[model samples]
Target: MAGPTLRTYKAGSIIYFIEDKGSDVFVLQKGRIILISNSLDSASEIKEDVQKGEFFGVKSALGAYPREETAQVLADSVVLVFTPVMFEAFCTKNPRLVLQMLKVFSGQLRKVHRKVREVLGETGQQENSVELLRTAESFYKMNLKDHANYAFKTFLKNYSTSNFATRGQSMLDMISRGQPYPVEMDSLETIIEKIRLGEMDVSQNAESTNFGDMQMNDVGSMEPPPLDDFSQPEDMHIPDMDDTGLSNDDGSGMMDIPDMDLPDMDIPDMDLPDYTPSMKKPPQMNVPQPSASKPALEGITQFYYDGVNEFSKQNWDVAIKRFEAALSINKFENDAEASFLEKSLFELGRTYMRKGDLTNGIGKLSDFVKKYPRNPNLKKAMAYIAEGYEKKGDKQRAMALYNKVVSMPPRDKESNYAKTQLDRLMK
Candidate 1:
């Protein structure tokens, strides 16, 4: 190949090997490639078969680290390549794409952290008490009560003489009591802290750097694994419909996400008294409920009211549907945004974020920012984007947005949070 241009390859051709200097990322125009992991002990094992429309060689291309896996053509293939400079420009325009990459990095970090903790737990009995304690605590916080209880008990049995033994016993008692604990949202603050302290494999701007030193899985990462699977940033295509073939345009498709039911906070090992049935019967009272026929799920006023109600109750899916319905009305006949559109839009975006669809959520919130620049929640939206970028490891972008909010007038909650982030990042 002469440049960042189309390169054709025959079947069974080696694209590049692990540790090879790979400055360009390839997009498969046609045909297939197999990413093989040729470890010293094993024969070249097929790691993944990449197909069209997928992105590959990304880690090495942006990482500036040597290639971590080998890409071998499985068929006669035509590829389009982009150099590092081109890729960086693409990432800047579509930050969401960069966010997706960061998610994969975070997932890898989580896996590595777990593996380290496991290794520590296995190496020594007393030396790894802190690891054991953390293991128990993590399980408890994650709602894995059985695992927590078992780990705590095991820690207590083995490290009875250790300082943490008392705390382990206390945790066991708390587990036995089965009280509801405050459910904390998943966060990368720990990872952020490690990065800040120079203990993590991250750069000042993870979106642009910091993949070389880290151990990232070729096949198990969050993004698609093929060189052909990635479309251009300009395309910015959404994935196909869910299993039900339902489109995501209307919020009804949110049925894809299951209800977020908190696990019952009851002791699993409880053994109690048996009750004898009493002869006396208790009085029953009749309760009234709405009629079977309800409001036709249409119109701005109806849907808007319903949306607000659902949003307040934290029924994100329902709220999304109502808000979408309200906004979907024709603009000329009824001012599409007259009544509750602004608030509905904000909540719709928030709902998406709550359900862990950051790409869509950020997109929607960004739209709100553009359309309603003077809305009271403008700073709040900025705050969300800042936190979103922070969570996705785009610290530089996050810092810029947080700084923007801090400079604005009024010491509101969102501004205060932004100030806090600014302080933390500067330190």
Candidate 2:
């Protein structure tokens, strides 16, 4: 079945002059080939490099062309010869591959054009334009999400420098003042602008406040502007105070109006519900008002533990249900979010895992990993995850994870136990 072509070349030898037979084609099986072009001396220049398992010369094989380049061997080379017949037969058998190749070529052409434009545009004077080009190039090469993350981080740095400290101060000030007092968004904006423009700086006592504390507040207490009122504060005029704390010395403006400077006038007391900033509201037994419940997750969890013990030990199903009920109560509690109560998620996840319900166990464990990536029990949760996988009959995956455990240095006594268990499984 062999054809009449046998070609061999020593290292650093010219296999064939591409110009010698324009219609000849090559299929490389062993060795490296460099295609050189446009140099008076063939050995002096290499335009394209090819290696084993590569096929070239298709363009020259058809009578419509001359060899655009010379092919040489950079190392000892062997190639299978393909006359025009073999190539035509391949194209006939797989028309879908032809279409796929054409699509790939079209995509490459577009990519090249885009790169050319980007390189040209990168020469522009604007930094953002240059940044954008670089971002686009990076996105093209490494994918968009990583570049998006970089861009987001850049935005975050500028944002934190200008806003984080001031906003934190504003929120703490609101908390100190009690009640969700009306904050002029424009005023906050102006403060940030002044800071960015160097008219002001972050106060020397800028203490960091956890954002979790802020979100813990009941949204109902924060009475956002009435739904249909789209008015911006920029449309309203507030008097500018001078060194004397007076509006205008001319005495002809609202400054002349008596009682206008009263603090009560600025902050009115209305029948609108008393919206305090505390995470929890006190229990009301004799007094009757609609009070919000603000139990910490810890209390709810403890209550569940107590309830499980107090409930009939004879009715295991009821005890299990009681435990689940406790979890539900803990799930709704928000007061402890800002402090030590934050460990609730880990507790809840561990409880679910102990319940031996794979769905809830996996769900809680996954969420714990997301919310607390650096938690001490993360490895333990991962071990539970492997158990869950095993429970689901994914033995291959379980083995892969067991291998990881065997390789890892134990983090602590618990992890040492896990590693020991993994070794026994292997045995």
Candidate 3:
């Protein structure tokens, strides 16, 4: 109600599909929908059914491109949408809502990042989806028609008995109505098989934890569907005229990205070499500035776009490459560039950390610190460096950095962060 205007789509209409970009949080007011994705060949279609009173499209377009899947109207549907601008305004108007939204963003982004890492083989698999699915069914007390399907049975045995069943079930519940399957069964099968193999490997190595106490007890059910208070059909209509200056309910038509919030970023400070008088001229500059490198810049921009695609698809390796390439081309401009760099470095470090190569992670963190000594994120970089050192069995060095972080002049977030790290180190 506080966000954007509402829109309605007839049944069978395609809302959006894989690779589309925009931020319009769709809230289903009526009718059913299907979330789907097709492989490159357009042969494989994975479908997930979304029910009424649910939200989709909100999570996928979080300032990223190439959405993971497509959404089709399964029936005459009514959806209330929120654009990023509208949502930001809502957050500004409501601090409580901001807190809740921040929590969701933090947890969801982290989860998606981890999933991308796992799927890209950048991180070792912890639990396979077969077990995840089985755990979901068991957590819901589902009785399968057949136990002969090894896939389904193993899913049950591992998921139902493991300590992570609750979390697994929650994921299923999110996708249960949203229909998150890909267009290709083969792709789905590939993912499934990977999970299965990963699970088997896990089983061979470690004892499964008991999940008897992992059940969620007091979670609140989702709120009822939002109701519109319009009194008449004509009330929704407006006088037709040229230059109406009206935007869609999603407000994407009015989209204009403001300067990025660099203060909130976790990045390093790098000294950008100023362009000399000669370098500023195309004829004299050696760095290939087609239009002073417009073509190369475009190529790098495309790479960043593709990286967003990969990031959305949970392909962390590919996404990281794209981001790295974009950084190489030209560091982003304004605060957006800073945010991108910070996020990229943090994620890159995280990817290495997840792979159990803390030494490499520490090196990356060190690079950030050396480059951006005055950056606010320098504090985070140092903290991560300390963590990396500790992970690499260099506790003495870790403690020294931790002490330095806490001893910084400003008694603000960085100082607090340093304090937290020092306390952790001491502990």
lDDT of 1 by residue, 119-140 (tens): 7764233247656766886787
Q: With candidate 2 superimposed using the best TM-score fit, by how many Å does residue 336's alpha carbon deviate from the native?
A: 6.4
TM-score comparison, 1 vs 3, better candidate: 1
Report residue 371 deviation for candidate 3 (angstroms). Answer: 0.9
Error of 2 at 294 (Å): 5.8
CA deviation > 4 Å runs, candidate 3? 1-314, 331-343, 412-414
Candidate structures ordered by TM-score, highest first: 1, 3, 2
* Clash totals, every prediction: 8, 0, 20
For model 3, residues 1-427, the per-residue Cα lDDT tens digits are: 4657788899989988778886777778888889997754578988887767555776665666667778899899888777877766765887986677678789977887887777786523544654445443343333322322343345545656543333233334333433332111111122233235442122321111111111112112111111110000000001121111122122221112111111212222221111000000001112222122344424443444444345434455665565566556554344433334543454455434434446555666666556545444455556666666665556777777767767655444446656766787788
lDDT of each: 0.54, 0.42, 0.46
Q: Give candidate 2's error at residue 409 in angstroms.
A: 6.2
Off by over 4 Å in 2: 1-294, 304-354, 403-410
Judging by lDDT, tell me the better candidate of 1 and 2: 1
Sorted on lDDT, best first, the list reads 1, 3, 2
Task: Using TM-score, give the best candidate's number.
Answer: 1
